[model samples]
Target: MGNSSFFFFVFCFIFLLVLGTCDCLSDQEKDRIDQLPGQPSNVDFEQYSGYVTVNEEAGRALFYWLTESPANRDPKSRPLLLWLNGGPGCSSVAYGAAEEIGPLHINSDGRTLFSNPYSWNKLANLLFLESPAGVGYSYSNTTSDLYTFGDAKTAEDSYAFLVNWFERFPQYKHRDFYISGESYAGHYVPQLSQLIYERNKGVKNPVINFKGFMVGNAVTDDYNDYVGTFEYWWTHGLISDSTYKSLQKTCEGSSSEHPPVECIRALNTAEMEQGRIDPYSIYTRPCSYTTSLKRRGRYPWMRGAYDPCTENYSNQYFNLPEVQKAFHANITKLSYPWQTCSDIVGGYWTDSPLSMLPIYKELIAAGLRVWVFSGDTDSVVPLTATRYSIDALNLSTIANWYPWYDNGKVGGWSQIYDGLTFVTVTGAGHEVPLHRPRQAFILFRSFLENKAMERSSISI
Candidate 1:
């Protein structure tokens, strides 16, 4: 058929190849945010938010918001970090994105957003996901699916979401990936990490490229948490000595998730003794607004900031029709407004292991980077609780306990275990970034670099 025919065939092949690539990218581009409705004008980074259907039969979809590092930072060169907030039913967009590590922070008016100087996106391409189909903007066509949500299914659906999400944002398919979260995500980050690690066992250079995970103020083992919590309350002078003794006697042997009547009574007594303080951030003033919603979960609600009313701002900001439109959320026009946590889902959580210590052992032995951090001021999952959980692991010490500094002041303390690293943010609360953004930023940078927190007083 000669030169003309061969050359024509080659041209057609190349044209189709280019066209197909463009077609694939167009799907991702559709989800891109040209600008958020109330986003700051000086912003010069790309952002995208949308839903990825995880289950077609049940019509379940999970929502995600990606905040890329500024162009000046060369976002393409950064690792991809996925952040989840655990209520077993919380919205990562509300907690992780709006307030904590994401680029935008909601204003008091709840309509406009301001730049977060210490947003995690500056260090990595940050992705916040709301999972389990009943939290925030994520939804299920089959209503019953919400009530049956549990650990195993949540992990499976999240894995599916990642698979489908990669198909849309193929550029990140092979990027270095890490999972992180706080509170109940103590279960999430590790469980998901285990699943990814197990699935990619024999495959070399898998698309997910999951390297490691980190959790802050996480719920680890029930037994350790109970012990540590009661101890913290007693030591901090929050609970009466009698209440502490009762808590130790009644709760040590009981399940933290489903306590017996005696344990519940003890907990109630402890609460009464502690009074009206914000248990999540013991030293901070509680939200004065009477209408502020408290999350009903196995664990207490984890919020960001010294101002306890931050969740109220998120509730107001995310419900705005224009904001939802910009986020490509609420397409189904749900019967309920957006909430920080879903009571139905959290209340109905079906299966949670008594301990995540075993998963930690497995992952650590498998050579994945495992880091655990605690915001010292968080009473919900306090530093004492984290310490107890890590002590249970009995991992060898790589670096002895040492104070880490930022800006010529003690930011926190650190200890490097043989297979895991542990950190404590000095005065941060349940959500470290909200309470201490600069120190949290440094902590994140150290986690990504797999280095110990700075021992020197010099600031980065």
Candidate 2:
């Protein structure tokens, strides 16, 4: 049984090993994008967009788009950064991918694309997910699932998506990973971070090497947000003294999600006083008269932008048959058109913790890198509100408030606390990258490098 038998066994083992490796690679290749319908011909990065079924029984699947770093960037050495956009019902693909930090941007014609020079993928492998079936191209077999979605369910589904996604792209399974998002994602980024952190307990080097998370213009503590928002409105001269006082009396201690009748009335009065302005970015011109009107009724608290009709372009581009086919999306041929944010999901949101402050405390104690950033001009989730929420944490300051520079100019102000870093992008809106891509790029680099923002006049 000597030489012949041993050599035969070794050859079979080698054959099986190579076969298994090929099979795994083929599974990943199924999701690869040969090219997008309107993508630039000169693109040098590998892009993949497809669905990963997270719940077979519920027929729930989440859609994801992964844009690897450009060829010269040494993508293997880069961290995998997952970007989410929070509406409880928004598409990260729409807000984060297309308009914010993704490599390709949709042009006004909705049938062409342009390169985003400051795309985050220039420094990291970027993954944008449209979570919680029923948003973007993601869907659930049961229609009712659309209306019952909430924070907890969204986080659970996203975690599941990540697990399954890693199986498809096993190469990234053990890569350093970070999650970042804006707006309601303030709730999402931390909640998911805590889940990953808790689940990995006692396990040796889990597949998900979740290192940290960052959120911009996020919704944190309700009480602090309420106080800070009212103060912002007053200080920014966007509300009357009477309306501000009314808001304070009625809104204090009230849940922003489910405010009392008096609070609702006060909010309505405040809106009237504030008038026809883009509440999201008070400093920028509204997208258009018609677009602003269309958005006003639906997203009173959270939409619009400085780029004006960027959302409209995303909506138009994503709904195209060719674009959907290119993205491997809308295969089910859903009855409705793709929207930037899902009204059904957002309107019928079932549950949200009144505060994310506890989660922050928990993660901070766990020694996860946490950063909270705000676009100083975003009235929707303004800098003042973020400041108020951070103040409530009572962590020891590592670096006192300092002006962080970008290209010899004050990009923003930053403060490094015991376990959290708070940053403000000076002229940005709720979607910082869209409004200020260069500064946002610098901010992202700093976050990933775990370095303080540049204090010198020279840019990195």
Candidate 3:
């Protein structure tokens, strides 16, 4: 309300999580949630502050834990924000805690506190969850424990985690809640949200008050997100005119695999002319910092500013042994396949047209406020794709096109209408909090205050 403004606008893009240390569930329910046959005897929901194991119906056992919201230090006044990391294979605690939100930085020393200036949990209780299985410390007594790891399986496991988790923290049963995540979560966030909304469809889950939802640089639609990379490349000077045109022609199919035969040709042409060398070329450098690495010839009129934290954050956070040991030391890599996106499992679940827009529309119809946001410069799930995807619903537009500025520059853009508002965070990539903490904080403030921003697209 002071000098701050809300966003309403157009696009979406995305890119790429974490953890062990589960806790939260009643002793009786804990016994059931530990539906695992021989889960470690030491794994007690009550004895441990984290690492509470959740037993699934027929899938691998998963581990999840809740951290009280950073904002509600009073304990009596704080609300709960359950955080999920995508990658039907990733861990929320690792990404949400180590990278984006959550308190304490597991310093390079692996045992020191650098203190993250921007942990979203500060505003509300943050619950980090590691879903699916075969990823992180989550496991199962059965090797056939893997359930094809699709959207259905993720929602099922997540729902089970909630049931057990809520039983543990019975006091938070009526707390206000918001569902959030990144990357492949395009599939997870909505499925879980729908499940929550459905469970509360008639009488509501007494354990909590379901609020709206949030996704950052998420994959709402695979088609648009894929094509958007070409548009973003052209706009950002990363691809030449020839390359852009070639991509437009060749990479025109909906297949998540290689672009169609024509798409390959376009890529080859672009590579030949513009000098791009990667095979999976549609994906961008997780963010601007990485783009800076590919910095090329002079753009006399362009600024050379760069951000060092973009793509390297996971390496920074997970390298800490204390952080690693927190999850019982399973995280192995310093590089990537940082599976925060679609789980490299059996099938594509996010492939469903079932994004949150319809769900947001339903929530809005019920008089709830809804906000969608993105990070600019993220070609992975570009803003253009978000706009294209949302336009299909054709929801009534309210806060028409405008600029959301920051640092005296056009950080990005926005648009709004009815209760659904889409906003873009300037200088951000796939993960908004990780790339633009200040802006992300400003966003949370507006969201909590009920003043949503409108942007042109959600970026990754």
lDDT winner, 1 or 3: 1
Models ranked on TM-score: 2, 1, 3
Q: What is the clash count for each candidate, in the order shown?
A: 0, 0, 68
Among all windows of 10 consecutive residues in model 3, the one with the lowest summed lDDT is 296-305
* lDDT value for model 2: 0.86
lDDT (C-alpha, whole model) for all candidates? 0.87, 0.86, 0.57
Model 2: residue 29 alpha-carbon error in angstroms = 0.7
Q: Write the per-residue lDDT of candidate 2 for residues 1-460, one digit (tens) a residue.
A: 7999999999999999998887755657877888888788889999998989988998999999999999899998889999988777788998898889999999999888999999999999999998779888999998989988988999999999999999989889889999999888888898999999999999898999999999999988888888888898899998999999998999889777778888888888888788777777788777775565554342334432333688878888998898888888888889999988877887778888878999999999989999988898877778888898999989999999999887788999999999999889998988899889999999999898899988977554
For residues 143-215, write the lDDT of model 1, one tens digit per residue: 9998999999999999999999999888898899999999889988999999999999999879999999999
lDDT (Cα, 0-100) at 133 in candidate 1: 95
Tell me model 3's lDDT, rounded to 2 decimals. 0.57
Which residue ranges in model 2 land beyond 4 Å of their true spot? 1-25, 289-307
Candidate 3 versus truth, CA RMSD in Å, comes to 15.9
